[model samples]
Structure formats: C-alpha cells, structure tokens
Target chain A: MDGDHACCEGALAAGCRFVAGYPITPSTAVVERFARRIPRVGGVFIQMEDELASSIAIQGAVWAGKKAMTVTSGPGYSLMMEHIGLAVMTECPCVFVNVQRGGPSTGLPTLPGQADMMQARWGSHGDYEIIALCPDSPQECFDFMIDAFNLSEQYRVPVMFMMDECIGHMIEKVTIPEADKIDVTPRNYTKLPPDQYLPFKPAENMVPEMVKAGDGYRIHVTGLTHDYRGYPVMSADCQEELVHRLVNKINRNEEKIRHIIATDIEDADVVVIAYGITARVAVDAIALARKQGVKVGLLRLVVVWPFPEAVIRDLANKGKALVMAEMNYGQIYYEVERCAQGKVPVLLAGHGGGDVHKTEAIAEKIVEANKCLS
Target chain B: MSRTEIKIGGFGGQGVILTGFIIGKAASIFDMKNATMTQAFGPEARGSACSSQVIVSEDKIRYPYVKRPNVMVMMSQEAFNKFSPQIDPHGIMLIEEELVDPAGLPDTVTVYSIPATRIAEELGKKIVLNMVMTGFFTAVSRIISREAARKAVADSVPPGSENLNLNAFEKGYEWGLKQLEG
Candidate 1:
C-alpha cells in the first residue's frame, strides 16, 4: 500500500468515523481510500465545497462525538488556517493531514515539499500549540496516523499529520497489526452529571475533559478566550488563564510528545537534521559521507513540532556542525540554528521543491560541514 | 543484489504505473525483499510520456527515486528517448519491439525487444501489454522470482480478468526464456 492508503487504514483503525475533505493533488488518495472503505466500515466521508468547509466540518463532527479529520495540500492548507486557529481555541480533538507539495500559492501540485513545517506550527494565528507528526515511510504513515489521533484526543489539540508528496505517493509494504494488538485511546468524556459538568475544567494534566453537543450538558464553544464554565470571558485575565494553559499543556508535556530517531551521534562531528522525505534521502547521503571518512550522523524528526529543542541543544553542545536539509528554502533551519545557540556551525541544504534533495548534493554539504570542524 | 532500480516507462493508459506496482508487490510481498515504487505525476501522465520508478533491495530502501536505473523497460518511443540516456552502463533494456525504435543506445547495453502489444492482442486484449512486459522483465532481469511475479500478477489484476492477464504474463515469460536460450 502507499502512504496515503495506509493513512486511511490507520484512521479507520484509530476509530476515525468521519472525514470531510476536498480532493487535491497527491493528498486525494487518502480521502479517496476513506470514501471507498468507509461505506462498509460505517463512517461518513464527505467531499465538502472547499478547504475551509472541510476543515470546520471535521470540527463539527468532533463536537458530535466522532473522531474526525481533514486532508489537504499546500494551497488548501493555507485556506484552512483560520479554522485551524478555531480548532485550537475551541480545543477540538481532530487530525489535520497536510500532504505537503511545493508552494507559496498553487506551486508544484504533483511534487514534494517540506516548506509547510513552519506553517504547521504557526499557520493559524495566535499563541497556541498543536502536535505535528512527520512520517517518512508508508509503514510510519499508518503507525503515526494512529498516534496523531491518540495525541489529539490526549491533549484535545488538533494534531497535524505532516506528509510530503514522496511519502504520500510512494508505494511500499505496510504491515498492519491485528486490531486486538493495536492500542487505541478513547476520548475522555466527562462523567459529571449535566448540572455539575463543566466542559472546560482541566484535569491534573491541564487537559480538560470533553462533552459532545448534546447529552443535556450546557457548553459554550467559542474562539474568544473562555473560562472553565465554557462561557466567553472578555478580560485579559481570562485570556491569560485560557491561552497560557492551552500552550502550557503541550510545552509542559514536550518530552512525552517528542519522537526523534538518532543514529551514530555519540562521536560524530557533523549531524544531519531532517524530517519527512528529506530524512529518508539523507540516509543515503549520510552513507556516502561516511565512506569518505566523515563522521556524519542523522537526527530524523518523527515528531516535528514542539521542535525537539532539548535533543538539538544536547547535540549542538557536543557535535561540531549541523546540516538542516529540507525541500524548501529553509523553514526548519531557523529552528535548528536557534536551538544550537552559537554552540556549533549550522548550515542549510535547502531546495526550492519540485523534487527531493540530490544525495550527492547532500553528501557534499555534509563533507563541507565536516571541514569546518577541522 | 543489494539494490536493483527498475524504471517502467510508457504513455498513460498503458498500465505503466500498474506494471511498476506489480513488480514492487512481487519483490516486497512475495519475494520478501524491500521495494518502493513512485511515479511521475501531472498532465503528462494522461496520455503523454510518463514513468514509474521501482527500487528493489535486499536491504532497506532509503532513497526512493531511481537516479540510474539498472533496468529500463520502455513501451513507447518517447519513453525510450526520454529515459534511455540515464540507464546504468551495465543495465538491461527491455522494449516493445513494435512501438519503440532503439536507435542511439550504447552497444554495451543488452537490449531485449518484444512485441508485447501484439502478444497481448493474440491473448484477446491489447490492454494486457503491460502484463506481458512485466513477465518478460521477470524472466530477463531475474531480480524477482518467477513464482513471485506470477503470484503478484494474480494478486494485482481485476478479479474477473485474472486468467487472461496471467496468460499474457506466461506468454511473455516463455518468449523471454526462448530469447535468452537462442
């Protein structure tokens, strides 16, 4: 199966019962599989008018007590930004899949790009955090998609499943474990009676329990800052309380949410930092560099958001140089450079999209970065 | 082989991508090797030139695309012209004899030509040309086992048309074997 089809299977396995999306290049296969499979699996797959409707409709389904998601690419991701902020402010638990392609606007519809890494973090306006996972292979697409849903339900944040065209379109063997073997996180519904129930009240984890639109619970879901009672609170104090908790819930639990795959980094002079398709391509480059006697290691970001700052900082403290390779002009490079904090030389091996980084080019960059150590 | 990169190229509606899929499926699922397949996207795939790149490896496949294909299967003149220059110096080139004119290829490159479309037509459906080509690829390249390729053909084709497709594959495989012996 391809990554897109594996993603659909993952969604089904994770109890995703509703999907609303507009067909777009590269990402269309995800919803296409969902549409065909959901009929027998007892779910709803709706092709909404555009990205905006698709983004918000999934939120409505989430409120109706269904695990839901929406899929899109670069342009459509741009369109869904406003609603992404809404999903954050209302604390809706849903997955947003961005099968990234080239573009500031309608760029390469059929090619791969990692330019949306920054957008996945800050595409939506305001001071809120969301979980994002980058899967490099078809197998991880299935495994991480389930994690994306579980993370969304765990923190009540809109989890972003960030995939590039290469991973989404590439076909590979994917082993799906038996349903009994797979662990699924059920939504945390409040047990309090209708009168006693407060939808926005936080548990010790700072993540509030959820309630659907019905069930006789009085709830007010709003984009504006709200109190524990779920009513709109206009003061800066309420904003401080609500927004601070929203950001803190993720920031405080960063260690639990971060997923990094490090290889041969203990005595390395140069480290290659990459996510999504770039990480897969960098594997070959790192091998080539190693043959030329450069101690280049790889730090593949499986969980790209929350930045994995501590790991990068730890590496910068010891490693001689870091190479950030991505399909864009350099989105995550700034983040890596920031975390390095002048401790080492940080370089960018950035492309303008359309295709993946050349293995030779990346190898050359690694060799150059290693020279700086000497 | 540690890594074998194969490119199946032709115009769209010719099952170019499906051919690559079956090959990858054979290697990964039946043969127990790792295979990754990616195709060229966009309008050119409608009826114009297009290609599917498949990498079969005993080890894990890291880089997905085929930079220099160890095997090139061209079903159209455009695909032949477009991709033949990038073939590995010691690679094997397979082509549809009736459709492509193998003019400028290097002498060192071993070229196997088959009238796959004609063979498929004799099998009662010209659309099965890709299957015939796939069978020929299995026999000549020897990368995927015959049993594995046959199982993949059956597993991939539409349910009702399995017999015809399998027949097409067998015909191509037999023809390829004859070519090798002679």
Candidate 2:
C-alpha cells in the first residue's frame, strides 16, 4: 500500500472506528481510501465542509467513547489548529495524520515538505504538550500509525502523526497481520458509577478515564479551564491544575516517550541528527564519511516531540560534534544547537522542501565538520 | 560496489510508479536485499510526466534514495529527454518504441528498444503495457522471480480486476524470457 493509505489500514487494525477529515491535496488519498474501506469494516468516515468542522467531529466521536482520528495537509492543518488546542484543553484522545505539504498558505499543493515541524509543536494556541511522530517510509507509516493511536489512548491526549508527501505517496510492501495477530489498546472508561466519577481526575498512571456523553455521566467539556468534576472555573488555581495535568501526563513520561534510532554514535567524534525524510539522507552521509575513515554516526528521531533532549545532550557531552539535517530551513537545527551548548560545534544541513537533500551535499558538511576537528 | 539505482519514467497512467514498486518489492521480498522506492508526478493525470526511483543494495539501506540512477526505463520521448542525461555510463536504457522517439541517445549505455505498447495491445489491453515492461526488465535483470512479479501484480490490484492483469503479466514475462535466450 502507499504510505498514506497504509495509515488508514493501520488505524483500522488498531481499532479506530471514527474518522472525520476534509479533502486536501497530498492527504486526500488518505480520506478517500478510508471513505471506501472503513464502512465495509463497520467504521464511520465523514467528509466535513472544512478542517475546523473535521477536527470537531473527530473530537465529538472521541467524547462519545470511540477511537477516532482526522487527516489533513498544510492549509487544513492550519485551520484545525484552534480545535487541536481545544482537544488539548478538553483532554481528548484522538489521532491526527498531518501529511504535510509546502505551506504558509497553499504553497505546494501536491509537493512534500517537513516545514510544519514547528507548527505541530506550537500551531495550536496555549501551553500544552503534544505527541508527534515522524515516519520516514511507508512501512514506518503503518507502524507509527499504530503507535500514534496507542499513545493517544495511553496519554489521553490527541497525538499527531506528522508525515510528508514523500512518505505518503510512496508505495511499498507492508506486512498486514492476520486477523488475530493484531494487538489493540482500547480507551479506559470509568468503571465507577456515573455520580461518583470525577471526569478530570488523573488515574494512578496520570491518564484519566474518559467518560463519554449520553452515558448518564453528565460529562461537561469546554475549552475553558475546568476542575476534576468537569465544570468551568474562573479561578487561577483551576487553570494551573488543568494545564499542569494536561502537559504533565506526557511530559513526565519523557524517558518512556522519547524514541530514537541511533547508529554507530558510540565513541564517534561527530554525530548527525535528522528525522523524517531527511534522516534517510543523513544515514547515507554518515556511511560515506565512515568509509573515508571519519568517525561519524547517526541519530534518527522517530518521535519528534518530547525533543529527546537528554539523549542529544549525552551525545554532545561525549565530545561529538552534531550536524542537524532537515527538509525545512533550520527548524530542528535550533534544538540541536541549544543542546550542544558549545560542548561540540553544530552544523545545519537544511532544505526548503521542494527537493530531497542530495547525499553528497550532506557528506560535504560532514567532511567539513571533521576538518574543523583537526 | 555501489547499489544499482533504477528510474522509470513515462506519462502518467503508464504505471511507472508501480514499475518502481515492483522492483523495490522484488528485491526486498524475494532476494533479501534492501530496497527503497520514491516517485513524483505532475498535476495532469494522464499526460503529465511521472517517475519512480528504485535503489537495490546488498547492505541495509540507510539512505532510501538514489542520487544517480544506473538503469533508466523511458516510456515517452519527454521522459527520455528529461532523465536520460543522468544515466550513469555503465548503466542500461530500456525504451518503449511506441511512446518514445529515440533519435539522439548516446550508445555508451546498453539500450534495449521494445514495443511494449504494441505487445500489450496484441495481448488485448493497453494498461498492462507497464506490467509487460516490468516483466521484461525483471527477465533481463533477474532481480525477482518472474512468477513473483506476476503474483505481486495480481495481489496489488484490487479484487475482480486480476484476470486480465495476470494474463498480461504472463505474456510479458514469457516475451521477456524469450528475449534473454534469443
């Protein structure tokens, strides 16, 4: 299956029964695939008039006690940002596949871009944390969609699968497990009586049990700050507690949430950091540099958010220079440079996303970093 | 040795991207080699130029893209003009005679001209021309089992649309196998 469609199938296997999305280039195939296949599998798929409506509908489905998700590209993602922030405040569990394309505004309708990296982090208003996964290939797309859904339910926060057109359109062989082979994680519902339930109270694991509407639980949800009873409060204390729990659920689990694939970074003088499609290029550059007898390694970031600062800082403190490569013009390089903190020099290998970075271009940067050491 | 890179290009709807997918899938599934494929196409569905790149490597593929292609399958004149210059000297070129006007291509690369469209039409459907060329390429390269290519094509296509594709893939494979011996 192509990468975008693979996400749909992966979600289906993961037990996603509701999807609400607007049709947009590069991401339209995802919705179209779901529209055709989901109903046959007894899942609900809806095409909303706009992205805002799409996100709200998915949130509604989530509140109604279903594993739900939405798909969109750049412009659509922007429109849904306000609602994404709402999902954060409401503590809703859902998944979003932002198959990113070139954009500030409809920039490259059909092209690929990782330019939305920062947007995924801060596009939605307010101070809240989000779980975002960056997948490099179609197989990764399938695997990560499962991960995205799992994370959303586990943390009770809406998760983002920030993908690009390159991964979405590229077709490949993905192993679909037999019916009984799949493992699914369902949302935890309150077992307590409706009158006794505190909808916003954190469970032992910090993830709250979701009480959906019409369950006689009297669940009251809002974008405004709310208390454990799910009622809006005007006090600063309520705001602080609400924000604290919302951010801390995922933030406190950084050690568990930060996933990275590092290759040969041990005992190396230089390490290259990359994610998404650019990580693929960085791997080739590291190998080529190693062949020339340069001590080079790679840090491929699969989980973009939660930053993996500890791992990066450890590599930097180990006395290895870091080179950050990304399809955007220096979005992730800032984080690497901050972590390096003059412990090791950092280099930026950036692209504006119309084309994939050439391997030789990245290799040249690696060689230059090596020359500086001597 | 460097991994061999193949780029197949043609007007949209010629299954150029699917051709690349078969190459990548064959290498990974049948030969146990690492393979990666990427594709790009213009806005127009049929007349627009589309292409897919395949990289075959003996090692685990770290970088999943081809910087310079070693084999190029050009199914249209425009595709040839756009991509032929990047073909490495030791590479091979396969052109579809019905679609491409190969007037000035250099002889440094081993070039095979085939009437893939004519063959597909003779076999009863034009859409299977891509599968025929896929079989021909697989026959020459031995990248995957010809039987595997037939199954991959049949399995990939949606249900109820398999019989004609299966026949076309078989015809193309047999034709390609014959060329290798003759």
Q: What is the lDDT of residue A370 in candidate 2?
A: 79
Predicted candidate 1 versus true structure: per-residue lDDT over B80-131, tens digit per residue: 9988999998999999999999998888899998999999999889999999
The candidate that wins on lDDT is 1
Model 2: lDDT equals 0.83
User: TM-score per candidate, in order?
Assistant: 0.98, 0.93
Each model's DockQ score:
0.95, 0.54
Best by DockQ: 1
**Candidate 1 DockQ score?**
0.95
The candidate 2 chain A region of ten consecutive residues with least summed lDDT is: A170-179
Candidate 2 per-residue lDDT over residues B1-182, each given as its tens digit: 64888999998788888788877777777666767777664464346566889888887565655667788888988888888888887777888877887666667777776789988898788988888888778777666777667667776666886887777776667776776677
CAPRI category for model 2: medium
Q: Every model's Cα RMSD, please?
A: 1.1, 2.4
Write model 1 residue lDDT over A1-374, tens digit each, in one string: 99999999999999999999999998999999998998788899999999999999999999999999999999999999999999999999999999999887999999898889889999888998999999999999999999999999999999999998999999999999999999999999998898887888899899999888777787889897899888888999999999999999999999999999998888889999998889989999999999999998999999988778989899888856999999987788999999999888898999999899999989999999999878
